[model samples]
Target: MNRIEKRLEELKQENKKAFITYTTAGLPDLQTTAKLIFAQEEAGADILEIGVPFSDPVADGPVIQNASYQAIQKGATLTKIFDMVEGVRKEKCEVPIVFMMYYNTVYHYGLEAFVTRCIECGVDGLIIPDLPFEEQGELKAVLAKNEASPILIQLVSPVSKQRVPMLLENARGFVYCVSQMGVTGKGANFHKDIREYLAAVKKESAIPVMVGFGIRTAKDIEPFEDIVDGAIVGSNLLRILEESNYSVDAVKEYVSGFKKELNENK
Candidate 1:
């Protein structure tokens, strides 16, 4: 198993839910972004989702959009991001790093080249927000050939009712269960049938099912913590990054709170 599969399995075996966190790469700057990785990991983040700066982010909310814009404006190119990731790995950041980006970026970067670079930099997974379930064939084929392949995670929303099975049929890593049918950020409501949807997904999926979108606090996830394998905190974490003024200490203090809350709730 790759780092992601192994990490999620370890969590499952330990009977503990995951605490996934996200931040845009090169936000504030690449150096600060690298510092944030270990901060989140130190804060008990099980999986680290790094948002790649993109010109057009179809699935992002205002918080992430602004962060991406800032990163791009500050010259956060993919090459720089990859170089930073390699450097971070060399420094021994153990948490699994997943890149959350658009398919257009992957396409422009060239699929094989992107996968090759990901292997070189130690990326453990990918979340392509706009990649349709039907079109994962080519990407999957590319990933299967490489050693320590970076998983291509599949996403499902409450609206993806009938497609859940199809999406999970050959899915790797984990399924990113979108909490509602909307763009990502805090302050959004869970889907009306979110509980049932999650239960159904868990029943159908062989891998772990982790929820994202609109989740700001452990309280927001308390009700569904039993139903999900983990919870991803993105916009909430980004908002912290904004409030913390990119301070690693602030990120750790705020992020570490989730582990306490999640464990206390358990």
Candidate 2:
């Protein structure tokens, strides 16, 4: 199993929920972004989802879109993000890093080339939002050959019950279960349907299911603790990074609060 799969399995065995933290790469600056990642680890983040900014982020909301623009303005690219991961590895950090990017960036870099770079840089997995199951053949082959798992995003709507099985079929890393029907950062409450959605996904997927989008606080995640394996807080965390005065200690403390909440429930 890849690092992502192994981590999820270990979390499952330990009866704990995984804390997946998201941050835009090269936001503010590359060095600062790296510091933020390390701060996340210090705050007890189980896995790091490094956001690769793209020009047209259709899946994202205002917060992430703004983050992407800021990172792009700072010249964050696939190459720079990989270098950041390499720098982190050089520092001897073992936390699993997954590149959360749009499909266009991968296309621009070439799927095989990107996969090769990820393996070399020690990227544990990938989360490409725009790449659908039908079009993932070549990239999937490349990932399998390199032993890099691609975590598929499972967007669960009211009509998604029938589609859940197909989404779970070839998914290796944990399934990114989108919490709501809309784009990222909408901040919707977890309704009764979310429980039904989780049950449906769990019935179809053997791997762990992690919910993201609109999840802001530990309270937002409490409802999912019984059904899903983890919660991904993106916009709220990114907002913290954006508003903070570049205090790594403050960031660490903020993340530790969320981590503590997740652990306390476990």
Candidate 3:
């Protein structure tokens, strides 16, 4: 199994939920981004979802959008991000790193080249927000060649009724279960309908299901414990990065606090 599948399985065996965290690469700079990755891993993050800077990110909210913009301004390209991943692996960090980017970036980078470099750089998974389920055929084939192949994770929303099964069928690593409609960073609480939707998704998905978008606080993870494998905190984490002025120690403290809260709730 790949690092992602293995990590998820390990969590399942321990009866503990996965804690996946997201951050934009080269937000302030690549050096800071590298430091943040290690800090998050040390702070109990099971998976690190690295957001590649893109010109247009429709799925992102203001927090991530700003991050993307800053990174892009700093010349954060796919090659540079891959260099960061290489540095991460050199430091002996085994925590799975997943790229959360748009399909346009991947396409522009060239599919085979992207997949090959991902394998080389030790990226364990990918979450292409803009890639449609129907059009994932070519990319999926490229990702399936290697034993430690980078998984292409599928996403599903509350209103994804008929398409849910299709998404689940092809899902690898885990399913990115978006909490609500519209763009991310709403930070809204889950209602009864949301709970029901998660329940249904958990029932149907064979792989791990991680709820994201609007999941800001530790309390937000409590309701999803039984229904989901875990939750992803993006906007809030980015907000913390900004608040801490990208200090590694500050980011670690925030992540540790979040982890403590999640453990306490458990």
TM-score of each: 0.97, 0.94, 0.96
State which candidate, 2 or 3, has the greater lDDT: 3
lDDT string for model 1 (50-117, tens) is 99999889999999999999999999988899999999899998899999999988889998999999
Q: Stretches of candidate 2 above 4 Å error?
A: 148-158
C-alpha local distance difference test of each model: 0.89, 0.81, 0.86
Per-residue CA lDDT of candidate 2, range 51-91, in tens? 99999888889999999998899898889889989999899
Q: Distance (Å) between predicted and true CA of 223, model 3? A: 3.0
lDDT of 3 by residue, 15-109 (tens): 77777899999988998899899999888889999999998999998989999999999999989999999998999998999999999899989
**Candidate 1 vs 2: which has more lDDT:** 1
Candidate 3 wrongly placed segments (more than 4 Å):
189-192
User: Against the hidden true structure, what lDDT does model 3 obtain?
Assistant: 0.86
- Report residue 114 deviation for candidate 3 (angstroms): 0.8
- Backbone clash pairs for candidate 1 read none
Question: What TM-score would candidate 1 get against the native?
Answer: 0.97
> What order do candidates take by lDDT, descending?
1, 3, 2
How many residue pairs clash in model 1?
Answer: 0
